[model samples]
Target: MVFTPPQNYNEIKSLLENLEAYINSPEFHEIDSLIKMPIIHYQFESIHPFYDGNGRTGRIINMLYLVQQKLLDIPVLYLSSYIIKNKNDYYRLLQEVRTKDAWEEWIIWMLKGVEITALETIKVVNKIKILMDDYKKEIRSEFSFYSHDLINILFKHPYTKIDFLQKELGVHRNTASSYLNALAKHGLLNKVKIGKSNYYINQKLFNTLTKR
Candidate 1:
């Protein structure tokens, strides 16, 4: 379905202003955040204010609104993945809202996305934490240079360079290179050279992050 938004600049601006006011208004504040969040997302997407990136901006607004309502400590819960997985339903339900005034189905679809995304995010976070702890224990047992900072830097970058380690750990360049080489020898990291620069890959962490 083709959804034509406001063609006039002033009309778009005025509508967006009203949207912002509604977000902070007492009427909106009274609604439960779970219910209001979907409404806010629908309204923002319907606005289609910018020439481009309206969908991306709308998703960002969803995270920010959750933060504002104290539903999330950080913007880690993303519904984009869920929406992408249900792409056809996502678009169909959105269009139904306009064509048939099917608000209930649209709201239910958004809430389901929220629930699935949140659960997946929690699982990923827990997995990362467990992997980090395992790495810390193994590295400490195997290497004299083991530090929590070293573990953090490895997981933080997944693919790291000698320069990154040198800067972050305030160590000499050669010292950083030696540390990385040692990890490679111990099978803790995979070392690769590309165009005169060597990089260390935390394969386990990389796998964990990229796993479906």
Candidate 2:
């Protein structure tokens, strides 16, 4: 269904300005963050200020708002994945808000997304930590060039290159290449050559990130 947003440029402009003010308003500050965010998200989406990227921008605003409230140390709790999985419900609930004034259902849906996303993020973080520890022990036992910095560099960039290691570890090109090659040879990294450049893939880290 096609929803008609505000068509007048001046009206859209004013609504967007009001949204900015509302977010920083004392009335907004009085509401709990979990409650306030969904309301703000609805307001932004309804305003639909931009022709494109409204959904993406709204999600970003949700994260930023959480950070601004000091509820998160970083803006890592993303609801995009959850929304993607339940896109039909997301759109339906949003439409219901405009048509039937279904604020409760919309707020509940958003809150549930927040809860599920937060839990999933925690699980992913724990998995990464365990994988990093395993890599540390195995690489230290097998390789002479093992260091905490090496482990960090490998995990920090799932698709790592010799140039990355060279700059991060303050090593020469040959030295970085030797380290990456050794890891690839040991089956710790899968080395793929793209054109003239080689990228060492941390398969476990890549899987962790891309896993559904």
Highest TM-score: give the candidate number. 2
Q: How many clashes would you count in candidate 2?
A: 0
What lDDT does the true structure give each of the candidates? 0.89, 0.94
Cα lDDT of model 2 by residue, 1-212, tens digit: 67888989999999999988888888767789889899999999999989899999999999999999999999998899999999999999999999899999999999999999999999999999999999999999999999999999999878899999999999999999999999999999999999999999999999997794
**Local error of candidate 1 at residue 174 (angstroms):** 2.1
Clashing pairs in 2: none
lDDT score for candidate 2 against the true structure: 0.94
- Model 2 residue 161 lDDT score: 98
Candidate 2 Cα misplacement greater than 4 A, ranges: none
Q: TM-score per candidate, in order?
A: 0.89, 0.94
Off by over 4 Å in 1: 193-197
Best by lDDT: 2
lDDT of 1: 0.89
